[model samples]
Structures are given as structure tokens and as C-alpha cells.
Target chain A: MTAARTEDDLKTLMLLSLDGDEGAYRRLLHAARPLLVAYYGRRMSGAAQADVEDLVQDTLLSLHARRHTYDRTRPFTAWFFSIARYKLIDHHRGRGGRKAAETQLHDKIEDDFSAESLTARLDLDRLLDALPPAQREMIRQVRLEGRSVAETASSRGQSESAVKVSIHRGLKALAARIRGEA
Target chain B: MRKTDDIIESLVGDLKPVARHALSRRFLVAILSSLAVSLVLMLTLAGLRVDMAVALTLPVFWIKAAYNFLIAAIALFALYRIARPDGDTGPVFREIAVVVALMGVAAVFQLALSPEAVYRRLILGHSALHCPFLIFAFALPVLVAAFLWMRAAAPADLRQAGFMAGLAAGAAGAFVYSWFCTENGMPFVLIWYSLGILATGLLGLLLGPRLLRW
Candidate 1:
């Protein structure tokens, strides 16, 4: 309870989550991720410990799915652990597991620009499209290209603040375009 | 297997972004399961009642139909909340309400019809949603199951765990609720039944840490 901020506060968070505030639910799930990671790590080979993180994410999913089953009157930790424990049982009980696939680290993005996407307009390529070629290059180099603004300024033989201003304007213009577009 | 510390940290941080999406889907599943139970009750229990003599009686038939319709209507109304990606049930009351409505339908139907007949038509005969209630129930589950199946198939890591864990957890939760659950009548459903289903969530949580492992 020492690291708990306040025991009563944590309890209230539990109560709020069980009561169904989406934001609180998200916080509750995230807060428990570390615990699940540690718990799953204990059951795994050291080299495979990273898989514990996967277990944490999976627990979030199941908790999300089964959240409705939680009674507000109960302790959040107790309710939270109940699902986690069951998931652990199933993980062990499961047999004939497949070997991990060697896949690219980068996630695949669906090319479809459906209206359903929340950040569909935020696609970097699309955002850059609205900027002039030099402005885009300046911004990309200093930002996505990961050069510091000073380095970018020096490379372009411009002052750092001027480079900053150029990049800032470029981003602003892009934002305006997209905001208007949206 | 690079085992580089930097790469591990990078990937770990990158994957954090996807967790919210995973949770949202799981929330959908949790809501769907309870809804499925209610749908089944609503469908099969049409023209349903607790007292057979009263159930089949014309006046009672309409009452049962209205009850079934109201349950379905509530589910439909709640279904709208579900359709809004960001909106979802806030507490266990919804879970219990759905269950109680479903169970109420069953109780009333049981009263009107013997368990033998109900089982004969549903289990023994293998009737696939022959009645309206059954049709509606089956429809909702089938649609939900399909969406979930497709979703799991396409995801980076299939959460076969979500469903498998959900069902097992659901049953376990029901078991726990049987302890705290007081079977009074409709009010029990309106209040206590939700408590029971929320209790089912306890099983989910107990197992979540292990079950969610990729």
C-alpha cells in the first residue's frame, strides 16, 4: 500500500471502473498491465520473457470483454485477478501451440482510407502532401528524419529558430489543410 | 531473436498503441455474450410464461409476447449503444439486466411449458431457431460470432483467448454468483442478476493475467 498513492484512492478507482467510466476502465487496465506482465514472466523461460508483455495485452482484451461481469461492490483487484488467474490456467492448459512466427516488427497498415478510421487524415504522407516541397523537406528532415532542428538548420545553412519557424509553419499549414479537409 | 535490448524496448513501446484496440474488441465480446443469452430467452420464450395453463391462455400469450418484445427492444436499444464504437455499458447492471430478462423469459416459459418439451424442441430435436425467439437469439449470436471470428483471424495476434477465456470465465462467474445470487423474481433480475453476471467477471479477472498471454 506504500506505493499505492492511497489505498482508499485505489479502491475508489476500482469502484469508478467497476461503475463503467470508459476512461477509468482504461486506466484500471493499464495500471494492471505491469502486474500481469510480471505474473506471466514467472511462467516463462527467461529468453521468452518478452511474451509476458503479450500476456498483459491479452489480459486487457479479456478484461474488456468480460468487464460487464464485474460487480461494483467488490474489490477491483479481486475482480481483476479473477480473470487474470483464469486466463493463466487456460494458457497452461492449452496444448499443441505453434512456434512463434518470424514476422516484421512493423505493423501492417490497411491502405483503405475508410471513414471509419479515427486518424485517417493524420496519415503522414497525406499531411505532407499539403506542404510545399522545400517546407516538407525541411520539416521531414528535422522531425521524421530525426535530425535535430539545429543540425537541420546547419545542413540547410539557416538559423535554428528560423528552421524551427519554417517547420512549425509547415506543420500548421498541414494541420489547417487537414482540419479543413476533415 | 536479435535479443537486442534497444529493439525489444522499441517494439514494446510500439505495441503499446494497439492495446486500446484490443480492449475495445474484448468489451464488445463481453457485451455480446450476455446479449446472446438474452436473445435466446427472448426468442424461444415467445408465447412463454411460468404457468403453462396461464402461458398458453390467450390473455397470457399477449403478455408474454409483450414481455419478450420488451426484452428484445431493450436489447435492441442497448445494441445501438454497442454500435457506437465509443459507447459501451458502464456497469454490471446491464449484464444482469440482459440475463434476468433472458432468465425471466425462461422462467415464464417453464411455467407454461414443461422442461421436457422445451428441451425436446431445443436440444433433442436440434431445432435451429425454429421459433421467433430462437431465430432472433441465433441470429444475434451468429452475427456476433462471425464478426469476432473474422476479427481474430485478421489481428496480429489472434485473441482466441478472449472467447475461450470469456466462456470459461462466464461459467465460473455464474458459479460464483450462485452464491450471492438471490432468486427473487423480476426485481431479482433488475438488481441481483446483474450482480451475479458482474460476479462472472470475477472469474475473467482471476484468469486474465494468464489467459491474455500471447
Candidate 2:
């Protein structure tokens, strides 16, 4: 079956929007709305649908503001998730630190296309093996499984901040390694 | 970490297309450019075939123009529909090159014979550039090649979801040029336009691998 809406499609639309096509921007907003609703609803507990709706509106606004940072020709979900994930973190950080064991995190960045997709195309399983376990795990849990930092932290018994920090550092390290800069 | 490209690209699908661009503008440009070229050539022919020059204002002149534009538009539209902007272009170019190289040979033969002498000859004209030989033997095929290569390499990336945009543009350009053109109805438009289009297809086939290689 055709896979879910991928990111490249979104990138194309965003680029078109940048080129003065309001139509593309409209498409981008439409596609990202559902994602925002599901994202906020899943993470916020005891929160009403209105809360999620508010978050969706907020996320779309933020996306519109920062859409320039996004690159065309990449996956929309990954970028969208990255934005959503950041919005989620901002939400948590805004609410003061999480409770001792209840701290959760999620990342919406789509790092999968550049790495896993390329790996599959190149069939470089051996190269993937070269990554340190923690770094690789971060990549897998966030990029592959579509988990947020909060979810990963909750599952792994790590602090939410720690999870976010690790993911940030891990991706940096992975980039260095991939580019032979390590 | 893995799918940076995918994650980054995902934002666009979130977008909804709000408008559609018609092929007419680009088509008009094609017509204008081609006609400009044809007019210059037609004027040149006036020195030789004054009768033909007088006939240019006749409705038959428009028939030829319309015919060429239609032929180019259809071929381009088909190509746009079938082309996958995201799909691999390497193999596509390999196929295209073979076709173009063969046509290049035919274009050489076409250059040797006089279209006027064979089809509409009562006089002769010459040019260092932009002649029938130059356009058919050179410009036509070259433009075709460029059009195909551009699509295979880098499409307009406009919001429009069609692949044949370049071909259509080329047809518009070529059709206008055809308005000024005369071939030995020996090489009907089928032969000429097809050859021109195939040459572009071939160009894409030959160069897309390198031009669009990631």
C-alpha cells in the first residue's frame, strides 16, 4: 500500500509556497493540522479536545512562522514532528519540570530519510553497526519509531531533559561520523 | 537522525494546493518565440519566394502554425504525464540517448536534402544561423535535448503536478517557430516534430544520468 504522507511531498509544497504560491502554504497547513491534533492529544492527560485544538492552532502558527527554516525535498512528517516535538517540549518546559517518574519526551524531527532511508538504499547494515549503541538507540527510538523524547524518557527511566540533551548530542555526533568528520 | 531529508521534507504534504497554473502562458511564449524565428525566416524567404511570402497572411499559414503547436503540445503533455519527477532518471536517459543519437544521424541526412526543393521550393534563402537546417539539424534537437534534460534533471518544481511542463513549453516555442518553417512535406510534421521531440527525449536519456545524478 502507499505509505502514509511522506516528507518530500511537504517540502515540495513549502518550496512552492516560498516562491509566492499561497496555495502551497495552504496545503502545508492542512497536512500538519491532523498531526498537531494527534500529537498534543496523546501527550496531554486530563486535557480536553479543546486543549489539543489549541495546540494544533499554535503549532500551525509556529510552523507558519518558522516554515522558512524547513528545507524542501525532505520528508514533511519528520520536519513536522520536529516542530511538534519542540512544541511539546516547550509545553512541558513551560509547565515546570515533570514529576519524578512521570517525565516524558517526544521528538518530531524526521531524521529517518537522510540516514535509514539512505542505508536501506545503500544496504549498509555494516555501517549502521559502527554507531555506538546509545547513539544508535536514540536514532532508532526517535527517528525510526516516531517516539517523542518524553515517551523515550518514560520508557527508559531517564529524565526528560536528559533524553532531549542526549538526542541533540547524539545527532550531532552521528552527523560528524556520517560526514567522516568524526 | 536517519531520515533528515524525510523529516525535513515532510512539511510540504501538510500543504494543500490552492491554485493551478494553465499551460497557456508558457505555451504562448513558445508560440511567440517560434513565430519570431519563423517570421525572420519567412521574411528572408520573401527575397526568393515572394509568392510564398504573400501566401503567409492566408489562413493556411495559421493552419500550419496551429498544427505544429498541437503536435508539440500533445507530445509534451504525454511526456509530462508519464514522467516521475521523483523517480530515478538514470535509466530513462539511457533510453533517451539512444533515440537522440539515431535521430541526430537522420537530422544530418535531412540537412543534406533541401526541404524547399522537395516540398515548397520556388526559390532559395540562406542563413548562417536559424535556418531550417540549423533549427532541425541543430536548434530543434538541441532545444528538445535541453527540455528533456531539464525535466529529468531539475523540473520547474512548481505546484503543478505534471511532468510534461517543459515539453509543452518547448512545443509552444517550437510551434511558433514551425509557423515560419517549410519542410518537403516529404518529412511531415510527424517526422519533423517527432524527430525534434525524440531528440529532446534522447537528450534527457543521455544526460539525465549525469545531470540528475544524486
Candidate 3:
């Protein structure tokens, strides 16, 4: 999202870095950090936020070591994302055992960004499962489905304030569960 | 959080200039070394076929040699391309299919021209029992050497990369084995030699996820 770091700019930096420009290399890594974090976050919302950061760092380290393998002629995003994906798979394998990781990577990589959305949805479902039915339904309608409070309250034949309270309590419970404090 | 920036700052502080040669250059070095060693081993242990002089005069012998060498070259090219994470396999897969189809056409012509008993003879050639195993044996060292180069290249898809490596080695092994093999029949060359290459490919597939896991 940095103004100075477009994909073309990053590609130029990568090419310069390959040519031994230490400053360009550092800039490239710095610029890539947020992109990598967001890449992991979309897929890791079901897991700890810390694990997402760890994956980003792992990818950066790999990108550093394998910088030479980058082809100057190719688009940098494809190269970078592919490496990010491999690291994500390796991290999962390390955590959940090889079978799970292998299956996850095989299932995910075919449809591109669908994998991240799928994981986020799956994680959200797991998180929502921990809440009571009333609260879960409120959060699902208001927070997930983006339904208006009035629409939700009208559908359920409840007052607007009661629906608002349910949404609030549901979100708080979800956060506590995510924080492992519930 | 600025976690990535902190890591970057630390990495930059410790960064040193690291010179890297082009991957093609490195790949050439590894493959050439492997082929050279395989050739030397083949010559030393198996020696040339007894009919080397007569076989050299024939077109089929040369075609067999050319076929194996061409496959080897294609596999090597695929290996280099796939070693990069961003590389696509579509082109190489198409190229491979075309080559295999051409070889198949050539095999059909060969089968048609030969006499009835020739089919049996070609299938049960004198080296039929040992040909696949010999080529497989020759491919072992090449596989090891290719794997070493691939590890440093950091292939994202190890299964495909390893398969390419195996293929390259297998073709080289078949080429070398051609010099020692007296089975001039195309069927024998196609079947046994292919099986030999497939064996290496299978080995690669098995080792792919395990060895190439980064």
C-alpha cells in the first residue's frame, strides 16, 4: 500500500538487488512485508495472528536467500506469491503434520485466491460455532452477511435494541474466543 | 505492526554482497558433469557393443542414438525452466508430448517394416533382461547430481522438478546405454529405454515431496 512501492517498482528493486544493490534489496524486502502479511492473514484468520506474522517472516527469509532465482523478465508478484504459498504449506506441515499440509496446498493452489477466502470463511465458521445460537445468528446476519439491524430485527420479530445487544455480545464473545480467553 | 520492517532492518544490517551465477550456467555445469561421468563409467565397465562398426553403418542405430540425445536435451531444458518458481510447465509438457508422438510414429514404421518373427526377437532381445536395470543404474548418479543443483535452486514444485531431473538423467543414461546395447530393434529401444527413464521418474516423484520440502 506504500505510495513508492508499486509492483513495477518492486520488480525494479528486485532486479537491482539481484545485481548486488544492497539498498534496493532492503527496500524490496521492506516493501514486500505488508503484502506478505496480508497474503497470510487472508488464509490464517482461522489460526493465530502470530502464525501469520511468522509465515510472512519465513517467506521474507526465503526470498532473501533465493533472490537470485528471480527472473528479471517475469512479473514479481507471481514469483513472490508462489514462494509465499510454499512457505505457508511448509509452516502448516510443520504444525499440523505432513498429510494435512500436503492436502491443504494441493487443494488451495489450483483456484488461486479462492484458498484464502475459503480459509477465512472456514475459520469464521469455527469461531462462530463457539457462541450461543442467538448471538451467533446475530453476528452472522449483521457482521458477516452485512444485514442492517432493522432488517435483522424485523426478520426475527424483535426490537432493534435487542438485536443490537445480541450483535454486540456476539462480537465480544468471538473476540474473547479468538484471544483464547473464553 | 512493523514486524516485517524490523526483520528487514536486521537483515539489511547483516547483508553482504553475494554474487550468483546464472541458473543456466549452474545447470549446465551439473548436467555436463553428470553426463561426462556416466559416459566414462559406461565406456569403462560395459565398453562398446560388439557390432559397433556394423551398427554405425546403419540408419536405425543413429536414429536410436539421436532419439535418446534429443530427449535428454529436452529434459535438461525443462529442468532449468522449472527450477525457477515462476516457471510454467505447459510449454515443456507440450514439447514432450510432440517428441513422444514423433517417436511413436517412427516406432510404427519400424514395426511395419520388420518381419513377423522380428517382433518377438525385438521384444526378447538379448539385453531385454538387463537393459532397464543398466540404464536405471546409470541414472542414479545423474539423479543425485541433478538433485544437488535443484536444492540450491529452490524449486517450488519439487514433484515436477524432480521428474524433469529424472527424465534428463534417464535420457542420458539411455544414450550411453545405446553404445553398449546391441538391441538395434526400435521396440526394444522404446520399451526398455522408456521403462528405465520411467523408473528414474518414479524415483523422483517419490523423493519429490520428501527431499524438496523446504
Candidate 4:
């Protein structure tokens, strides 16, 4: 389920904002509000809605301060999500300065968040499905599971070079698929 | 629920961005100006290598210069990318690794091509012990200048940002040092030059959390 806002719409609004269009900037933030809520909502399920709202506002303020740093050449979401991720990491760190316990909780939260809602939000599975089985499996193992090519190669009984090639080609194809060029 | 309108109101009320186009310009100014300072310092303090006239005529000299310049350029590109909150250093890192690996190969190739006794001489140049320190010394000014400019932006990954700053400064320093350093051996560049860069990178890593706290 994609947000009601399309990537194009977000880009258009951001472009307008960059051009000194304050109205467009407001509208862009307005448009982002619900998506941001949904974003924080999913990760922070069972937690107070206020916490999610606070995080959303925090991210928006951060975006304001950092807007100039945005490169016009790159995708807005990559820039946006990275900011969100940082804020989330900071949020966790601030609340859970309990040290060792904090890392476990953070990892658990990350896995829980990404496994379902995040994957669906990004449409990762559909893109993966479009790839050939070998490439798809390669991407899943290497990219998703964070397995080394050497390890994956040994397990799959393939040469390390072959594994590396597959991972490279797989990611390239995935990017093409995301761009609708596949 | 708190009103989204209120947040929007607060954001738009007096929000002036640092200016979008100005960011790139600022970065360019930082790198160029710092590099200029480093170059001036090197020229004044050490002067060019004694064989400067002879070295300028050699293709190997140009090749080595190209290698150092490319490393700096690549690191600068990486730094520029990560200047933004969302910039990813993963791909840039691979490119850097590939570049360093090629340098290693070039060093080995130079070793193999040269006579057997030349190995020790190439690896341990007259200035082998002092080259890394010199490079590190040159890198300091660039690193400080870079961090000053970089502090204006809000980087999410302070350590990485600092690391990038260090890498960029180190590369720039090495590039400048190439003029003063008479050592042509690839091993000298690979070992001493890299260690110098690494030292700066470590310094950046150490300072990142403190400097880029925001």
C-alpha cells in the first residue's frame, strides 16, 4: 500500500519549495504529515500515539534545517528516509541509554518494523518477485540477510566470483525494475 | 491530536533555509580554499622536490600524480554526497576500495618491473619514515577548514561525516605533498601516503561525535 502521495508529487512540491515557494513547502509538509504518521505509527505500534507524533514533528523540523543539504540530482525519498532513520536511531538512544539492553531492543524494533510494514511500503517484494529466481535469491541472501558473497557462494556451492557477479547483476536488475525499465 | 497545521505554521512562520544553491558553493569554497592554503604552506616551507624539472618530463610521474589526484577527487565526491543528511557512503566506499586496490597493483607491478635490489630502495625511500608525518601535517589545515564548513550542515552520521572530512582532507594533503615529495615509488604512496590519510580519518572519526553533535 503506497502512500496517497506519489513520488512525482513529492518531488514537485520539494522542487517548488526549493524555488522559494513557501506555499508549496507548506503543502509538501502537509502532504507528508499523514505518511509520516503512518511511518512512525507502524514502527511504534502498541506505543503511545503521542510518541509517534513527536517523532514526526522532530523529523519535520530536522528536514527544515537540512533542506539545503538536499541534492537536486538524487531521489527525495532516499534523502527523506535517511533523515527519518537517523531520528529514529537518536530517539531510541535517548530513551534507552540503558546501553546493552538498548542495542537488543533497537535491533528487535528494526527487524519488526522492516519485516512487514516497511517491505510493503517500499514494495520490495514485488520488485524481488520480478527478478529471475537465482538473482532474486541472490539479492535476498546478500542484500536482505547481509550474507557475504563468500559465505553465500560456499553455501550455494558456487564460486565466489559467480556469487559476486550474481549479486551485482541482481541489484542492477532490481534498480531497473524499480525504474520500470525491466 | 496536535494539529499538523500548527507544525506547518511553526515551520513556515520564519523559516529561512540556509539557501539551497549556496550549500554546494560553500563546499567548493571550503575544499579549494583549504587546498590553496595547504599548497601555499608546502611551497613556502619545503619548496618543490630537487628533481622537479626532470620529474615533470616523465610519464610515470604524471601517472602517479593522476593516482593521487583521483583519490582526492573521489574522496571529495564522497564527502559532497554525505554532506546531505541522507547521503550514503556505501557505493563511494567500494569505488575508493577499488582505487586503492589498483594503486596496490600498480605498486606491485612497479616492484616486479624493477630489478630485485630496487625493492628495498623503493619501499624504503630516503624519506620513508618522514613522508607519512609530512602528509599528516599538511592534512591538518585542510581537515580543520573542512570541518568548519561542514559544521554548518546537519549531518545524521557524525562519525561517517567526520570520516569523510578526514578522507577528503588526507587525499588533498597527499595530492599537495606529491609536489614536495620526490619519492616516485608506488609503495611509498601506498604505505606512507595511505597511513597519513588513515591517521587523519581516525582523527576525524574521533572528532565527529563532538563537533557534529547536532
Candidate 5:
């Protein structure tokens, strides 16, 4: 099946599960496991199989607990991936991973060519528009424009620290927007 | 640890239809109930200001209440949004900033219009020393309620979510305290009330990572 068809099917199953359809819920969980494994496996390259499976289970549990947070108006895949990404981040933090590792993980997650990641990326520009102009410009320069913080700071005639703070706040706002959206 | 299949089976086994908008409902219930508790606490502890009748007739009283109420409303919405795994908090933060900024402008205007001698009185009301602590005390119930509800939901950024919850609770507390507070100066509210809210937010920021580990 096409990726679009798969996502639609998953969404239908999720809706049914939300309606208390146990069978659909079971199928949904089953279908999601492989995707979770693949997702974690790709990023956690050298990690043991057991560790990856553990992370998958953790994500599944979180999904179950946070089911009520799922908005019917949102694309299910986006919601699923967000939760998945959150769990992955939590896992890394739990293990006392360095900030660099977390940053790398973020990059890998964004680089993912999965249907959900693509959908989320498509929504990124719209989400950025919701930020204040200053924050939006900072994010565009530092993140989308891929300029160094020093360069962005000099160009904008702002302190480097100010530029960093703006970019941080903007990214945080973008994350919040995404979670609020899908 | 249990196998993944086992976990799935168990999750499905106890499946129940969750009410739609359950998160919002839970947050609303929490805020309302906690506000009620805070109101009762305020009335019993401090009682309404002696000149409540006169104060009610004054525009300043309503202005203070309205300001706190607006902050509470916006912060509560932000709290609710951030409790969700994918919820957005950016817009609410901007909105709250705007509300505070407007109050700041109001305070500046009030300060400008007042006599120079009353400047200290306007900025530092009789309760300035204790106002923030009192507000923080009153905010406890709501903050506790918010934290409890947040624990059940999946928040992406624990510190940010906690701060939002604290801001909402603190604003609610300030709104309740306004009934008993005799301070008529906008600067007092702008300073003391904001300090109270900020302190609570800081507390939340400090506790979020530890309490919201789930």
C-alpha cells in the first residue's frame, strides 16, 4: 500500500480505538510496533536489539496513557511521531546522554523521510508564522537559513547571546505549536 | 520486563471509551475547584477589605481584578495546551506578555498622573512586603491541582508546562486576593502581583523536571 493509504488506515484504526474498539486498538498497536522499531533502530544504530525494543515498548505505553490528548482534527501520524520522538528524547536523557547526542537525535528525526516527518515538515512553515516577528526571523536565520549564531547576531546588530536566546525561544515556540497542532 | 505483546494485550484488555476533550475537561475542573478553595481560604484568612463597598464603586478595584483575571484566563489556556504531548504554548506566552505589557502601560500612566510624594505609596503598598508570600500561599492549591492533572497528561517540555501551570495558579490566587487587597495602585499590582506569579513560576520551573519525569 502507498504511504498515504497506510497513514489513512492507521488514522482510521486510531479513531476506532478512541471509540473503544478493542479489536481496532489491538490492530493499531500491532501495526505501530514495527514502525517504532524501525524508527528507533535507525537512529540508535549501535544500540542493542533489546534496548531498541524497550524504547518501542516505552513509546507504546506512553501512547496508551496519552490517548486522550490525541485530537481527531490532527493527522494521526504526526501525533504518533511526536510521541515517539518525545519518548526517544526521554530515553536519551534517562541514560545521561550528552546534549550533543540529543541534538544529533533531533537532526536525525528531522532528516527522517518517513511520511509523518514529511507531514510535520510541511507544517513547520505554518507554525513558524505563529511566532512573534523577532522570534520568527531569528529562527529563520539560525535554523532554516543555516547561519551561524555569530553571523546572525552581527547581521542583526544584536548581541550573540541575544541571538541565541531568540533562536531558542523561537524553536521552543515552534515545538509547542507542532504539539498543539498535530 | 513484560514483552511488548503482553503490554499491548493488557492495554487493550482494559480499554474504555475516554470522553472526548477529556484533557480540557480535567483542566477546567481542576482550575474551578482550586479557585473555589483559594477563594474560601482568602475569605476565611484575610477577609474582604474593610472598605469593600467603597472599593467596589471604584474603577481601580475592577481594573486590578480584570487584569489578574485576564492573566489567569490566558495562563489557564496555556496550561491546558502544554499538558498535551503535542500542545503549543508559544501563542499563549505571547498573549500573556501582551496582557502584562498593557498593565505596565497602565501603571506608568497612573504613576505619571499621581503626585511625586505618593510615588512610594503607589509602588509599595502597605502589603508589599507580604503580598507575594500571601499570593504564593493562596496559589498552592491551584498549583497542586495543576501539577496533579499535568502528571496524567504527556507534556513535551516539563519545565515550560510547569511554569504555565504556576502562572495560571498564581494569577488565580491574585484574582482571589484582590477581594481582600486594599491596594488601589496599578503599580502595586504590576509589581507585587507579578512578583508573586513569577515566584510561583520559578518554583514550577524548579520542580518540573523532577515531578514530571513520566
Candidate 6:
């Protein structure tokens, strides 16, 4: 597909996903993976395949977590590539790479990727599984199950504020896990 | 590692419509509420200038208030943009530079038009020693509020975001304190007030990587 057509397609999928269309969201992620893989592969030519795949997965996770920050009025590709570039720079910085080279590379990757084909694998269930049962349960209900805090609070015999705090702390802990701090 | 497909499945399993403009709303609410707190704090601790009616009638008082308010407004705009994952802060930085340069020009003009005898007094008002520190102190609540809300957002450059947060809080603090500050010199506001805002921004820079890791 042409770049303009691809941008339109992804933008439509993203809008649909934001409107809570599961099918559209899945397609969006699926569509994003290959572009991410190709993008990372080009930058990290000397890195292991697993490392590149990990970066791709990390980028995807960040995209999922930060999807709400995407402004509908902006180009979808710009938003996607910004997150991708951030993760790339973050990956290098975490590994003690040269700052000047990283910045030069950053400028080089300013353009968005064209549609391409590739495959990769990764997971988050392990991190979730490591959380305390109560925290895990709270996160699952409010975050994954789409339940209101009040409903979860009532069902769990806890105050609404307590449920809110639990979810907040739980998410914080989950974030710590993602950062490898826990 | 688990399958990427499985991860995608889990993510899509229970998707919900995120509230539109939620990020900006949270940021606005955070800054404004904390500003209100700082105002209350200043009122309780120092009270307004003794000659409030007289101060209100003077153009110098409004100039001081406007100087601080303008910085707060621009810095807040920068903070808002930097809080987003894809938000660019380049334009905001240029805008802030423009505001500061304008203030610098105003200070120079104010000095040139006045007699040289009072230059020192104009620059170093009675509250010179405490003004910047007090501005920093009043900014704490707003800084904390900005940081707390910012943790929920994805800022690409943590230090830059933190600096903007501090800059915003500091200018806001100065603006709130302007009501109680009796100093009517443009040089005093430009120098001491800017120092306070710079100190807060430095503090934010130091704390960004640690407190804003998420």
C-alpha cells in the first residue's frame, strides 16, 4: 500500500480502537508489529534477534499503556513513531551507549516506517502473576475487567477510596516491575 | 517470554473507551488547585500588602504581577506539552525565551529611565534575601501536584518535563506572592523572581529521573 493509504488505514483503526472496538484494536496491534520489527532491526543490526524482538515488544507495551495520550487531531503515524523513537533512545541509554551516536541515530530515524512483514513474541502475564493476590485482583477487576471502582469496592466489601488506592498502588507496582526495579 | 500474540490478545480482551482529553484535564486541575492552595497559604502566612488599595492603583504593581503571571502562563503551557509522549517542547522553549527577553528589556528600560542612585535599591529590594526562597517555598505544593499528576503521563524527556513543571510552579508561586510583596521595582521582580523560578527548575531537573521514572 502507498504511504498515504497506509496512514489513513492505521488512523481509522486507531480511531475505531479508541472507540472500544476490540477487532479494530487487535488489527491495529497486528499491523504495528511488523513495522516495529523492521524499524528496530535496521537500527540494532549488531544486536541479537532476541534483543531486537524485546525492543519491539517494549515499544508495543508502551504504546498500549500510553494510548490515551494520542490526540485524534494529530497524525497517527507521528504519534506511533514518537513512542517508537522514545523507546529506541531509552533502550540505548539504558545500555550505556554513546550519547552523541544515539542522538545522530535518533535524527536518522525521524521518518515513519512503511508497511512491512515480520513476526515476534513476548508476554506481560508473568509480571502480573508476580503481584500480590489482593493487588492483582484489584488490577484485574478495574483495569482488565472494565469494572467501575465503586462496583469493585462494593463487591469486595471495601470502601470506594480503598479500592481506588489499591488499584493505583497496584499499577505503580506493575510499572516498577516493567522497569525491572522489583 | 510469552507470545506477542497472547500479549496482544490480553490487551484487547477488555478494551474500554478512554475519556477524551483526560490527560490535559488532569494537568489543568492539578496546577489550578495547587495554585489555589498556594494563594491561601500566602494569605494566611503573610497577608496582603498593608497598602493594598494604594498598591492596586499603581502601574508598577500591575507590572510586577503581570511579569510573574506571564511567566507562569508560558511555563504552564510548556509543562502541558511536555507531559505527553509525542508532545514537542521546542516551540515552548522558544516562547519562554521570548518572554524572558521581553522582561529583561523592560527591566533595562526601567533602570535607564530612573536615576543611577537607586539602581542598587531597585535591584536589591528589602526582601531580596527572602524573596526567591519564599517563592521556592510557596511553589512546593504546586510542584508536588505537577509531579504527582505527571507520573500518570508519559514524558519522553523526564528532566525537561521536570524542569518545566518546576518553572511553572515557581512562577505561579511568585504570582501569588505578588499580592503580599510590596516591592514595586521592575528590576526586583526580574532578578529575584527569576532566580526563584530558576532554583525551582533546577530542583525539578535534579528530581526528574528519580521521581518521574514511570
Best by TM-score: 5
Top-lDDT candidate index: 5
TM-score of chain A for the candidates in order shown: 0.44, 0.50, 0.59, 0.55, 0.58, 0.54
Which residue segments of model 1 deviate by more than 4 Å? Answer: A1-124, A130-134, A140-158, A161-182, B1-51, B54-184, B187-192, B204-214
Greater DockQ among 2 and 4 belongs to 4
Q: Write the per-residue lDDT of candidate 1 for residues B61-145, one digit (tens) a residue.
A: 4433343344334433333233222233334346535655665675556445654545443222232222222232323342344
Assess candidate 3 and give its TM-score to the true structure.
0.79
lDDT preference between candidates 1 and 3, better one: 3
Model 2 ranges off by over 4 Å: A1-182, B2-49, B57-63, B78-132, B137-177, B181-197, B212-214
**What is the Cα-based lDDT of residue A109 in candidate 4?**
45
Please provide, for model 6 over A4-93, each residue's C-alpha lDDT reduced to its tens digit, 9 standing for 90 to 100: 126667889999988899988888988888778856876775745668778878888877888888889877776787777777777766
Q: Report residue B110 deviation for candidate 1 (angstroms).
A: 21
Tens digit of per-residue lDDT, candidate 2, span A1-182 = 22124455556766677665665665656655654665576566774555666566666666654444343444555556655655555555456553311244413322333334632422233333457776667666887569988888888898988878877877776567778843
- Candidate ordering by TM-score (highest first): 5, 3, 6, 4, 2, 1
On DockQ, the candidate that comes out on top is: 5
In terms of lDDT, the poorest run of 10 residues in model 4 chain B is B12-21
The models' CA-based lDDT, in order, is: 0.44, 0.47, 0.79, 0.78, 0.84, 0.81
Which docking category, incorrect, acceptable, medium or high, applies to candidate 4? acceptable
Model 3 off-target regions past 4 Å? A1-3, A97-99, A106-110, A113-182, B1-6, B14-21
Per residue, candidate 4 scores C-alpha lDDT tens digits across A107-139 of 854564432354355457557766889878877
Better of 3 and 6 by TM-score: 3
Q: How close to the true structure is residue A43 of candidate 2, measured as C-alpha lDDT?
A: 62
How many clashes show up per model?
40, 61, 0, 0, 6, 1
TM-score of chain B of each: 0.27, 0.42, 0.91, 0.91, 0.96, 0.93
